[model samples]
Target: MSLDSISLEAIRKELLDKFKDEKITNIIQTKKYKIIMEVKPNNFLVLNGINKKRDTFYIHISIDPSSMEIYFSESKNTEETISSPFLNLLQNHLIGGKILDIKQPDFDRILHFIIQPYLKFGQTQNQILIIEFMGKHGNMILLKENTMIEGSIKLVDSNINRYREILPGKFYISPPSQNKLNPLNVNRKDFFNIFYSLKDKSLNLWKLIQNNFIGISLQNAKEMVLQANLSLEKDVSNASQADLEMLWTSFNRIINNIKNHIFQPTIFLDPLSEKIKAYSLINSIQFPPCHKRNFKDANSCLESLFTELEKEREILSIQNKLDQILSKNMLKINNKINDYQKKLEEVKNCEKYKINGELIKANLASIKRGDTEIKVINYYSPRQEDITIPLNHKLTALENARLYFKKYKKTKDSWEIILEQLNNNQLKLAQLAEFHKLYKQYSNSLPNLLKIYNDLMKLGLSKKIIVPLKKQEKKKNKLLPAKYISQDGWEIYVGKNNHQNDFLTFKLASGNDIWLHPKNIQGAHVIIKNRGNKQSPPLETLIQAANLAAYFSKAKKENKVLVDYTLKKYVKKPKNAKPGMAIYSQEKSLLIKINLPEIKNMISQNSQGKILSP
Candidate 1:
């Protein structure tokens, strides 16, 4: 809903009324970087302006009883007391300047601060403070004696840039190619004409206001629309008689509601849920009336559920990434272990003759003298010049194999521990995947349950029947069963599902009442009481009852259907029978086509009593 011209006008009127009796007393900065002005009301502080052109322009203003100080990013480290150039200039002019009037350039667009006695410095006077905030674009302008002193601009000229100047010496100019709207010059008729030109109803009021005027948020536009009681779509130029009436009524109601309920928070709903809720309400008059669910609360629950699912998805993504890295590393480590084992085996298989040759080549005196039975020595060269040898009386190859086997055992032991950790991590990854699946199922089940309940309610069931279904239960059984009433006010029992069917035929129904069921089809078992009298059952009544059976049955779309009817006494529920499953004998079959509208009318009439209760 766009804020049309009419709504903007209303906002303009409101702002004018609010500030009519106020004056700017002090200016300060909010923690969020907004500029706030203290006015005469004393009870309220107006957010005077905002800095939008550059984030660097955020200046903190502190007000004390004795003096006011302004701090900017550049002055953070100065230990000596020094005034900000901008603050000093503003203070000198605005300290005692009496605000003569305040005007918005266009409704909530830009504010022109008109002050009398503009500060005189070296014969300069008539300084005015103009603050412009047009959403993405905003600036502050200072004018001394009608000539601009300095103003915020999108681009600084070379003269200003070279001199590092944003001061009173240079003249101020409006930004290039800026579309400015003067609100004071626009009248109601002009606004009406402009709004009427737009034909699209879906255009948001805030967006329209922002495009045509300036400086309006969606919240502010919505407030204006509420104040006007106006249909955001009603075009003044093309309104038909009916449209005019609707527009007028809506406008008046909205305005009155706003005036009565000032400062109340806005209520919003999910569109999808809202539509479903409406459908449920509309369809329930014909079917069993379902209980209404709070769509707002349901939407909130759904949002949280989705958010939790998203978080789980992110966690799963991280786990998968980690598992991939671990698997790659494990493969690399296993390959290294296998290669090292092969090298160790090669070392162990080294020939004893080669070792003996090395021992002879080293010329160890004991071996040469044959004093050690010509023992072979397994030797390792530490350097070209030195060799260390250990002689084994046994064959030299066996001794070398023993050393290689010892090294293999140590390396294998380390690898086994690493493999154990990998196996544990893989198990954890599988568990996480399972958890994600279960969470999704659980999240999905809630909406399905809600949909089923809503569908059932649209069938015209009373709250007495509907409320019990929402309760927690230990077993899958209905606390309250479905009951039907005959045209003569005789109570007839009908089963909703298999379990209820069993109960109705055996426990609830009388021996004399005729039982009804759609022949050879999945449907409710309906029993109509036989009022022992000469009067015959009206054809209409019989058809109505049959329609209920067919409507609730699998043969709902068949033009004609065979329904079995018999005494309740003939119907019997077997031991350990499932819901809606019952056996009966001595049944009479009647073929009749179902008339849904007539049955609905009958049910609706019967429900009047229940509806009037509260």
Candidate 2:
């Protein structure tokens, strides 16, 4: 969800307190979505309520259209990077500058960070980093005096948005306002006056508040109803005088908190599902099942939430790409198979040509020249019925017989060729079916899915999955798998890609180690390091590994999936087999339902949301 204006106000206050007068020592743009600013300490280094020992400041700008965030953070996950023009522009201007002020303009979800360069006395200049946390429209723009746009990470032209074009040397304008009432500025008198003047008394109180008020979200509107001890579903027009008074009092109480800076930033998480649900300034009393994590500052809250959100979005992006490639290939193969089937049916009648040839040759004496067709007694038939042999008018009877024989021979050859092509097409369709099955099972396992997709493209069996191509190097690269520590303290490894699967199953796993995979399903190969012992894993640990197999296979959506487990020694890679393909022997199978939420929660709580490299 986008941060509402009230939350932005809280963020503004937090950043202003934490970063005022600090010089930006360095700048790092780790990815398109994240930017890091290193700040030098402004005073003696005793960290407590606000200031910390850390020197880095983070601004995460998500490109997602539904939910976007640009908030202060202490750190972010380090990702591979390439040179970016926008990063260079930001570093040239923002580095070695002191943050002078941080403000949210008119309670909008835009943070204007004003800074002055640490230059010679005669050359000092002021600049602004305007972060718009407005979903798909969200962007980071460098400005001179907050109006003239010097540059932006993203360029908005007339084609993208006619309302405002953000470009170099152009005047930057605030997005058009909705003209809703600013909750902090509206007094109790004005608040009551709005409800009293409402022509629709039957409107729900929560809807009315959300529609008429700025900086108030649906959750906050519901909170207001709770504070007033009134049902959110209650009609505002039918409310009693006492109820209206209570509501107005509650509304003022919230507005007063915004005015007095009484912000209690909280991020609500569902522990079971392991999902970050919502955030608010005031402590939420609703959502009992959700784990409410109160933060010392909103920056920390936003950092953790948006970081996880970015990872989830990345996984979704990979899934979408896989879906597109698989769907495209599947549709193409299906059409080819249909056409081949029709050709096979048409050529199935090749025997009729041979029969005509036989009839023409047998009736050669009875048939005359210049005849289009001739009727004769059918000696080849079981009942000896009469038969009509079509004749070429210009050919002699023997020549016509030879022509029919040639036609029969040509169709017979075509029928054999078509049958071979049909067999090859069916084989390809089966391979694609396997790919689709694996894609559905392991869409969440991005690394493995990507590996499989690359393998398909390499074999010329699937369309190329478009990705940013990296410069090739003359080196032998190692593959990494998803690592998790089991509840029994044993290390478990699951392959992310086909290369990783081969590496895990053949190179990393010892003979005595345990191997697991979803039975008759396309999924990641899972291995449990057994310390070279020829013993079975604990039932719980075995189930845990099996769960991974199920969760990462085509059977992920099924109620119960069969998972096969055996000693690593029993798993064998065939010569010239496709990547990730292997055979196993002496395996035991378990039937278990996959609880993805529980599995994900386990991974997060145990592994700290990090997949280890092999």
lDDT of each: 0.47, 0.78
Error of 1 at 46 (Å): 26
* RMSD, every candidate, angstroms: 22.7, 6.8
**What TM-score do all the candidates reach, one by one?**
0.30, 0.73
Query: lDDT by residue for model 1 over 1-614, one digit each (tens)?
Result: 22222222333334344444344444443322233344443233335564332211112222221212222222222111333445445555664455555555434434556665434455445556655443333445567655556543222456745533334557654434336343335445554555566677455553455455443344444444444445555444444545434433433443344333222211233343321222110111221233333222222222233233333443454345334443554455456556655555554533433544555544544443223344433455344343444444444434543544555565556556645655654554554443343334223233222333333345332232222222232123232344556676665555655545676677766687667899999887776655674244566556666777777788989999899887777887778766567788998888978887866676666653121101
Clashing pairs for model 2 are: 441-553, 448-496
Which stretches of model 2 miss by more than 4 angstroms?
25-54, 62-65, 74-92, 132-143, 146-182, 185-204, 207-213, 252-264, 269-276, 291-296, 358-368, 374-386, 459-464, 468-504, 513-574, 578-614
Q: Pick out the ten consecutive residues of candidate 1 with the lowest summed lDDT.
A: 275-284
Task: Write candidate 2's Cα lDDT for 1-614 as tens digits.
Answer: 67878878877887788889988877776667556677765565555656555456654554445656656656443555545777888888888889999888777778888999768556755999888877777888889874789898889999998999999989998888988887878887888888889998889888888989877888989888888999877988778889988988888888888888887777788777666777777766666635777777777777667767765676677677777777887888789889888998988987777787788887778777899998887776799998777788999888888887888888889888988988988888887787776677556555555655676778686555545222221121233667888888788898855767998898889998999999988888999999748367788989998998888777889999999998999999999998899999999999988878869987778853244555
Off by over 4 Å in 1: 1-84, 96-100, 115-124, 151-155, 158-192, 195-241, 244-614
